[model samples]
Target: MSGRSDKKGEMMMVQADTRIVDVIRQMQEQRKQDRQIFYDIYSQQEKRQDPEKKDTGLFFFRGEKKAPFAVVCAGGGFYYVGSVHESFPHALELSRQGYNAFALQYRTGGAEVACEDLAAAISFIFSHAQELGVSTDCYSLWGGSAGARMAAYLGSYGPARFGGDDLPGPGAVIMQYTGHTDYTENDPPTYACVGENDGIANWRTMEERIENLDAAGIRTEFHHYPDLQHGFGLGIGTSAEGWINDAIAFWQAQIDES
Candidate 1:
């Protein structure tokens, strides 16, 4: 490891082999200035009613102030949260593109539980959007694998359907390598990407999703990468690299439509 002076004129450790976990750890260590973590977002009634609600939270990786944001959920097959692989890398890339991004930690029993936490996280963000210096209009929902299911569900059914306030659906939904097949004509504009060799989530399933979205009159873009696997976060050196830029372009188009 080596140390270098950052823009703040403070020395920071530089890792020779940088990884997404390293970036996220750096952000966590520098949370005082780099990231904001919101803890335990249950409403007063829910907190009082269900005394055992988990303490999952949201980690915000900010970009341009007042920019529309994307809420990213990582995949863990409803058992764990893979933020290191799926959330932080995506958020970091989105931030690099000048978009505010949040990586959410949801209760991981299943999609239903995870979606509830996502809904609460979105509600929390919306409630404090002004203070957070983010615009609520045309924000995006991004997820990978199981998390993609959560994002897709919310994109199809607004927050209110999942016990949150009746907030507008995300302007765009970015899904990566998930077997999410459900769709509606009202689904937000979607950008989907999958690897031809993704054993976990079939490329054909994603193709079907795109077909359904297109048939239903939803604006969508689908990319099929060659020789990539399920959880290729940020794509790094893989064939799926640079997909985030295309997703951002899709999101910007949605904002323009708004």
Candidate 2:
């Protein structure tokens, strides 16, 4: 890493459990192939109006043209955006599986601001779907830790609640390692996973939420991997390894039902 790359890497709280290098390599490959990997969700005028929006954008990992898309948000406890460790890799994997994927780079500081950025990002993608070559239908939202709360909030209340346009929420919401318990009767179908040993976000909290969703007659799936801890991006090589596949299936099931 050097220059801007090094600067970006410095912002990441690199952990032994994360595959930051792999994400960097994949991003490099995408750039080498001449793909437009990043898109500013906010226009220049918007950024000028609110300088905080300058860091907000979407990093794309393209799949089949016009295929359904997903937006992945990485968690950093609202202090930083961990897209390299948590989101970019997931988007790359999703693209490999033939789904257009985007890793969101949102402004950090507070939950409300983050959710607003997410809503704005969703609106940006929807507005540019045709030019971006992605289907507006059956799109999903994914996130880990604090980011999971953002996804769930948007899933429950919708983008309009967060200052975005009146738009349909995701067909599914995939959450990881978060203890968010909020829900609404109209929340999208949801799939969630957490590590039982996660000290920051107790697995019981997640399980209880899932149970509540089920009791409310909402489509849901929950998984808790024993002995694993928090921030296990992709859970690769752990008991939670391959969990993303299960989540993908859950999302697909929602699409089928819809």
Candidate 3:
């Protein structure tokens, strides 16, 4: 098993053409086998009766006791199909780095419950810090695109605050190509590159929220791949290795600092 001090971190390769629905099903099986931790935390409308369903299948990865444990969220637009290969790979990589890493297949959508799921996931991880061999007090949220949006939302408004004297939330948050927010000069070049796809024109209602999070002192880091589109950081297509390396570097810095 790769670990923090080890040169080779945990690695995952998101397979091509895998759909989100299947991912959800696979996770369900894992849950049944009792090999998984944390809850799926979705709703009825998101499941049966709706005919067509979209669920963020959750995955958990544990590691040695350490600060800045990770709650990784993968970017699936308000609807990122579960790219387990893209998502869990990163979590496993981080775990091997010796931090408790969780790849949350959070409920996707603008539902109020979905938002709750995000908060609940972090709270759940922290809720059981000891079993995972870490302190719940310190953790970081890492996500891309849709996952990034949710992470930023939770990071900004979810809880990770410092107001109530020892606020309950992750100490760090990172965005690979977070959509669903306005642009800023400090945004990564990728953001500028995806003008039409992830452009400022893309989000109008949530700009204020993004700004508010900044104002609240949330440690937000935005990375834009000027040439890569929305899911650039997902380690898909031709850039999987580079994406993983970039993610490893990004995550390692956060973990060590955490």
Count of clashes, each model: 0, 0, 12
Q: Write down the TM-score of every candidate.
A: 0.87, 0.92, 0.59
Best by lDDT: 2
The weakest ten consecutive residues by lDDT in model 3 span 187-196
Give the per-residue lDDT of model 1 (tens digit) for 21-56. Answer: 566575876575644555457766776786546557
Q: What's model 3's TM-score?
A: 0.59
61-169: candidate 3 lDDT, tens digit per residue? 6567654577677655556434464466567666666677777765555534444556766665555566656666546677766666655556545443311122454
- lDDT winner, 2 or 3: 2
What residue pairs clash in candidate 2, if any at all? Answer: none
Give stretches of model 1 more than 4 Å off: 1-17, 25-35, 43-52
List candidate 3 stretches off by more than 4 Å. Answer: 1-57, 160-167, 182-222, 234-258
Determine the C-alpha RMSD for candidate 2 after optimal superposition of all C-alphas. Answer: 6.1
